[model samples]
Target: MTDALQAMKALIEEINHHNYLYYTLDQPGIADADYDKLYDKLVAMERETGIVLPDSPTGRVGDQLLKGFDEHKHRARLWSLDKAQNHEDLTAWHTRAAKLVNDYNTRNPENPLPPLSFVVELKFDGLTLNLTYEHGRLVQAATRGNGVVGEGILAQVKTIKSVPLTIPYTDGVIEVQGEGIMNLSVLEAYNQTAAEPLKNARNAAAGALRNLNPKVTAERKLNAYFYNIGYTDGLTFADHREMVEFLRENRFRISPFVRYFDSIEEVAQELDAVVSMRNTFDFLIDGLVVKVSDMRTREALGYTDKFPRWAVAFKFEAEEAITTLQSVSWEVGRTGKITPVAKVEPVDIAGVTVQNCTLNNIGDIERKNLKHALGSQVYIRRSNDVIPEILGKVTEEQDGEEIVFPEQCPSCGSPLELKGAHLFCLNRLECRPQLIGRITHFASRDAMDIETFSIMTAEQLYQELGVRDPADLYGLTFDDLIKLERFGEKKANNLLAAFEKSKQCDLASFLFALGIPNTGKTTTKVLADHYRSLDKLMEATAEELVLLQDIGDIVADSIVSFFRDPVMQRSIERLLQAGVNPVSEEAPVIMNAENPFFGKTIVLTGTLSSMSRDEAAKKLEALGAKITGSVSKKTDIVVAGESAGSKLTKAQQLGIRIIDDEQELLQLLNG
Candidate 1:
């Protein structure tokens, strides 16, 4: 590497660390004056050398934002790693790895393999960014949109101080891939000036990098830490750990924590250690990336199209945080249920700021004794991006005070009633939260399919137009919407069009939209199949409901209770009066029983030539095929593509029929 290039790499790394301290962790260890001096020196050096690296921060200086992002084809495919959520899955994967290694050793007696070892690193929860450097100079950067082609954010990425502008060149082109994310500290700073609350660090980094405004991306202060050296012209390593160490030596921002183990059991221990220390890092991590250490072994194992065969990700189940609950506040649901929401100190969990956690019901609070104490530390769990829930109170100081459940409606102050593990506010028509929540649900995608409707819009309709129930939504006219604050003629027309489109939703979806407690999509389907229409299902007795498949006593009673409520009856009548007629589905089209695939559980793997996997699954589902996620004892068929891996092996062992091509898939579905 040239002297200028060496200095540039060092300067870039120094600047990146400074950025990490200030922008990422919100702890600037160095003074602004000292940082400014280093930056000036870098600019002067760049000018003297007349060699501006592609990822040089100097290029970002005074650079205007591009009008739009353009697509850049990745030089190499960025394959995803297969994931294992539990020990059993990981053990299964490890067994497969052992088998492959044993087979390789058997094939080549002279080069017998050692016990399969792995290198583990934190699996960052963020967008994948590929930064390519040619002859030691950073040249291009792209988002890993579809593995092959990604939106170009070269200009935006140049502003990331942590990305090296140049490196020590000894070989051909180097493609470095990393997780690009805005940490919680950066999110806090950005939200201060942003018009909206950024959902999380990962999304914020993705959106910031793709923003048309380069300055905006710079202002957000994105960070990245390289994990894999995806492609190289002439570089080779005996193992993954050596290659990563080389990357670190060359001034790349590699992961700080790296460990190697000879056994899967040892790797599992490391995984636990990583999870325990995950929150202490500046970046967001969702799991641990475990890779077969030997490069030769990796080559022997090869890869599947969707995932690398030599590596797997042990993903964490949930993001949790312990925070003190300050007090309890009751909020009335659409069903007139007054649920407790524990207001807590703002805690970060699952990358989002949670100020309050749901207590479910009065019965739940009494059972857990959460409301019995204020200023008590509580376990808040955020699962699958759902609302945070207060799991239970944690042991803390004895000064915590007892919580008193409210006896009246939080919104309307009406006397509350107790009914089987729930506290209800009988003022259903008047409670503001109930009205808004119900209207929001009714207009939601799964319900009425009103795309233009939102919680904000629902609140406006209820407060301004007195939308007492879901049915009143149909009465909204363009003229009425035109009077709202942000709604103009075009917005009004769009909302009206959405409403008109929703009037045609089928019986199952409509039934689910009623917001019946404990009744989900499958329950709605069962109900629709049995009764054929909404009114028939509503008129049925609890005994009739209990007779159906999967319908138990509690669900039956809830269904009956909802239908018998006078307010609910009036709501349905209003919906009928508004011409919101739900069409019943005809008897399900019976697939020929003679078809071999009918009633068979099947799993799909790898890329198919004719159509996408999702499209294939839909067509097969229509023909009575059950699409499954993994290969198992119950899987009757396996669809294998060019690079199908572990699942294919499992299917072969189980002696299941393996379909090879899209043509075969089409034949099976058509027959």
Candidate 2:
């Protein structure tokens, strides 16, 4: 029994250390398979002995579903910070804090506080988490409920690998405050394969934490950043910097940025700098947090009824606002998906006047409880700088006119059908909007690379030239194009040249131009590389497709169904007849095993002067290289070009191999 306990203790400590290294430092001490073996051994030992250590790593994987969250009283109150919308508001806040500090110093001259220095950190847009540790062991984790109390979510919080199960600080009791967030890159990766894509990272993190199933939370792979030791029974610090060091010593995952500034003017300048590079961060941040550096000054400044006087949140311009929904219009996409576009009263958000917001579909409208929200105030947000989307109605009781869902296609008057969370019109060929959308997408830069092509051009060709399918574009001549309303001699000749140039496209571009449902550029590229020809891809079975990496059942089904459709087959026949020749230019007769880039995950960033990045990627793929968008520890090499940005910097920081010279890149491609 003693030997078993000792073995368990050793295993627990080793596993916890590895978790910290991998999650907090982004440095893996061991391979995943090796770590799993150690974990399996520990689990087997635990089961055999029927004894689990208090700080056992196995507890991170919560096997049982929680019925409900129990209320927990926090050791220290989680205070909210006062917000500063502009520089004026921030200046006023600093003035108030300085005044309070001066008054305190005057009264107690012998014990005068330090000069009013400030610490600035990013105000992460995520769920506030309070983790309570007793005798260095994490005992409880909770949400910030009314400052004084919170709902215990220990099981859910444990799933975060960055959060230490046991800290080096063997304090009596302590509460650490941090924000839990899902990285934007992680969110994008999740959305790619997820059946129901998560709308935003902030909401995704919050929803996962509050979920009844810890398994669901684990799947999200959330991360956290500890900023403050909210409560401590056996620790003291001279200033915020010292406290930060203590947090770091205890193996808490802190943000890389914790800049200290003595002058308020410097702090303001720093805020501006942060705003400029805010998008570069992997996580989402709404603003910067300016806090008093001196702990004694913070104590002297004290707290107000709602917010702490020592700190202020320098908030960015509002990205979300409530606007009255005037009407809803259903628009048809290239895939026949009917999307609901809500025309709202013009409201300014993040400096843009938003009059229209997306409701996604009828199902999305119903899911968001916006069925009876027309003419009512609806909450809208500009997600990822794209078109603003309607979150929901402000009032849940629905005190306005009902938003009627269209039973028929608005463009072609065909019967609409619900497939999952979207409404689809089966009228593919005749629908004006659908045909126009299809043609526009087919001529897009990433697809057919048809220069000077726009939605207006597609519309003109459809109406004036009697163009329907993408194949019709190939048949267009100078005489036909010159007859159009906007077509002059030069414009007609340029359009004809572009059309001719696009006919000799590569297979990957041609496949992407087809715009198969549930498939994007990446998947189409994969399909092209795997089959090496259009006929082979068209003949591929779902079973064979699923064998390819990243190609799931849904995507495979979408591919198979699209090619098997008689309409699509007829369209392809017409395209072939019109002299459109899409060749597999990058297909190697025999893949070389000795190639340096073979089987290596490579990333391309910035502008390549020799060739387009897409063209370079295809050449690399032919030599058996896998190209990814983002740079991470997993990335083997980064092919950087002129003016490489954050990705290049990250690659350098991670010590990944970089190929920056254009001549070197050209040699590699040619080699």
Candidate 3:
């Protein structure tokens, strides 16, 4: 009961947030089908307890005209099915069924349970309707409002051509439950000139169905699928399959993808197939519903106050949406790479409002065939934590203007070069974006460990002192900083102190901090492992660099090109003069055959209690251990501390030895 209350509160908040996204912001996160799943659950809860929250979306009617549509009492109550997000949840449900069946078998040994079979069908994402037929003609249609009394959208529902106005053999009172939907094409057409654009097809169908005018609904070209029998008399079906067969034989529109699975594994596998072909359908679908085949079993496994224990919906991740591609926001990276970020009109995909998603490069733009000229609508995907990716342009509805790529840098006005797949700016040292990126990289924990320095402070330094390079940061004075907006005497002291502290960083740290193109932390570690000293690496020829383990021709050229720059050379010299010393990793290591940590792949993750992660890695490297970035089968050990994530899980799965903290690591290092 407590769980139900919490679920009710959560559902209310979630539904209201989606409502704001759809109705107000014009950017809905989830599709109408997904929204229905959540709404159905809330309604089921309300029906069970008769407890309704004032702010719940279940209590609310259409966007407008609540009083316009006449209310009609439903013949029988409507209920919503609970959902399962993953295969594990589905398996758990099956496990519960096994327990129930086993208990039943114990009670009646002579009537042992038969092999469990189930039906899996595509779950439509649209508005639910309860249609009633008298004799051989459709009499009324209703929206599932509070499950008891519904808004009589009979005039509007009659506009749907897919619904059968007259079916043969329709005797006594018969109530059929189905979904009212609009196709992708029709929704697109309606949104093109609507006063306020429709977010998706489901929402469009819903609004049209509840419309006071029947003609408004007629123009939408709505469709529907009848799946469940709500209220029935003078009919006795053996099972769900028999009833669905009746609907299909009578020419009622039903989903095409329906199959019987003898096992949960087969059902789970079929779900994967459904997902793969989800986009093939003309209409949208959220998930597939799995139900017990035997009506007797369904009766035995009765209702759990809300949904039936006999069935559960297997939902997929959020569906995709198409929206206008307003324009692109081009920005420069630390490597002077010009990236194209799409500025899309707010659209919801999978419960996320996406406005900006990266297009990567010119090649990517051409390959995806994006018109990208400020008016074309694009196909975008929004998944959890994933940056929305523009699939491609869906329509060519755009203004007759083209977005020309600039040859000159937007920041420093230097000529841009087409470097392979990306655009690069020659003005590396002077460009504000690159300069800030470089300084931010330099002050990063894995680089120089300058904790007090930030991008804002870097900007302040640039504006005040014209400090344009990473080395220019070390030359800043306490007096120079004290004049800035937020820098007080204490902050000035802290900044200077942090700067002084970074000078004692390791050789690999300094190389990584230099912000040399393509020389990431891993590459620096490889260089540190091979060359043993920063000066030796700086003096090495490109030919010599290419001979090293992981160093490729491109990386070698980048290293040679960086050291050849007189400006970069001066910057390094000035940094050295300012007391920045790149130290070796303690002592040179020789292979000791019996050393406990010898020639083993180890990964370091999270914060170390004693020293920084870089320091610990270097120390372990000095003891003939190789510190790697990721955990794999080759990894002999994983040194994990607090807040360990996926790496820890991988290590545990592989049965690899784990060093809990620096203490255990040190113990193994000395042993």
Candidate 4:
């Protein structure tokens, strides 16, 4: 070999070693910057010399031109997951699975339903691949092509860093099914510099895998999470969870979010929790995969040609829709920022009828040219499955009508000023729409937990009851509510009761209820816990607010803006005058040095056998435990009883540690 070729080989070896350490073993000998420098040097050398080794990392970008995929019949038919659209569908699927298991157990008492349990995993939004390993070495890999037959992609699959070239399972063949996913962060970073950005992570992965150069594929940093053992020899796992554990133990890249649940409710809770934290995860997950634990039970349940009866994917509602844009209307939010809303023909998206989609700001509208037509076909997608956004215009025809930016606010008719892309309404206190939205936000469950006051009710109360703001809500009487259209005595009474109940909320909740732009429940709680009173919090400056944990410039600015408002100040004063007491300062109990439950949040549900609820709470408090009435992300342990309700369900959903009895609690506390 030439000197340059020898040097290139050495550099490639070094790069591969570091890559294995960083990606596979989670241990890096050198810094990422240093590794990148080494990789760059190797690439430059290879380019200069025009000599490239076959097994070099640079050679793994694209797959070789295949004549065609070799037809290979699967040992067992790979069935798709039966999809559940919503919670009701999920419950129905669970019920059917349970009934099937019960029937199986009844018929064959001796060989019962092998301890029914479920392995819940995230259904990745990517291509699925089936990898077959013979005698611990990867032999073949194929796509899930029509379940029965698949194209061979073994040579290309070997390039994936996560796909192990060899496994620990000896003297047997095992087919592992998994998703080939592109990391969202990596895709975003690549898109930032690329001339054309990929639409999503799934599409990015698909494009990268089909690339002509294997080196390009390696550059994408694709990952795989093996979930199913399609065909295994000399390994008899009774349940899905066990099989997952086995795969994990054998150094296979398994889905980290996979969990075992005892009941269907647990599965539902898991699904909800996954949806809640979907944004936080690095990879894209479309839904939750729930499978019957027992292999025999699964076999008995059997499969249709398309989907398995025993397994179901609880899919979240679709966030994308194609619709005709009827017109565009600019609306001012609570912050006085003018958002151009596309008045589209009503389209069902994500389980809700979306008639209006936010154009974000003037810049967004102008860039997309959303306001050019009265009847334009448009594609819309929800960002993070929450906020509706217009992707782009589909049609090219515009009736030569120029789209103009609104000079005045839609609600208050106040003059608008352009602050960069956002048109700001100067009428803060007088804007009726802003006031209504603010009041509704304040009374929301995450803020003050005012159950009865919705947006419509707030609007009616504003116009009919002569209430301008949230403070005016306290002035409303049952008689006033009863007088409104469609409001009966019972509904009025309930609203009044809810309003009354909200008056005694904690200082944190009250702070959040102020509808400050960036202040959320957790931030409010932190501020309230630290300051302990609204008076102290109100006195705090922007700098002081920013000093708190997780408080950034945006949040600090919002807090300062809210407090600086004369109308908001008057509202707070009026609330105080109306006998709204927001003081709930519970001193944290200090525990002994030897206390077992130091730094743990525990929730008690149902009735305790050994101790009263209060007694149990007191004991936990004595051990330096912080007690919360509800189970949330904050709750660490849940002491469940015979019939624990939603709290228990939420606890399980959040993956909070649960203790069934007093003994388990004691063990956890001590440990």
Best by lDDT, which number? 2
What local distance difference test score does each model get? 0.73, 0.78, 0.74, 0.69
Where is model 4 more than 4 Å wrong at Cα? Answer: 1-240, 243-324, 344-356, 369-388, 394-400, 591-671
Residue 544 lDDT, candidate 2, scale 0-100: 99
Q: Report the lDDT of model 3 for residue 380.
A: 73
Candidate that scores best on TM-score: 1
lDDT of 2 by residue, 112-176 (tens): 88889999999897878999987789999998764676779999999999999999877366899
**Candidate achieving higher lDDT, 2 or 3:** 2
Extract clashing residue pairs from model 3: 29-351, 33-125
Candidate 2 structure, TM-score to reference: 0.48
Residue runs of model 3 more than 4 Å from their true location after superposition: 1-318, 396-400, 592-671
Error of 3 at 576 (Å): 0.7
> What is the per-residue lDDT of model 4 for residues 1-671, given as tens digits with 9 covering 90 to 100?
23454345444444554444433232333332233345445657755764443224453321112223465556545666656767887888878877888887898787576656787888887667888887788888876654666656676677788899988876556788998898889888888888877656765675565555667767777888889888653355667877888888778898878788888788788888888888788988877788888776776788653467888877665455678877777766555666665677886542245666555566666677665755777877642222355767777666424557888888888999876666778787789877886787788655677866667888888888878877788888887788899899998898888888888888877887776654545677788888887888888888898898867665677788878888779989998887788985674556666655777887777667776667778778867887755665556788886556566777778898888876877675555
TM-scores of the candidates are: 0.56, 0.48, 0.47, 0.47
lDDT of 1 by residue, 466-518 (tens): 88789898898878889999998998998998888888888878887887765
Model 1 TM-score, all chains together = 0.56
RMSD of each: 16.6, 24.2, 22.2, 23.5
Tens-place lDDT per residue, model 3, 356-400, is 655656666767776445677777765322245677777554442
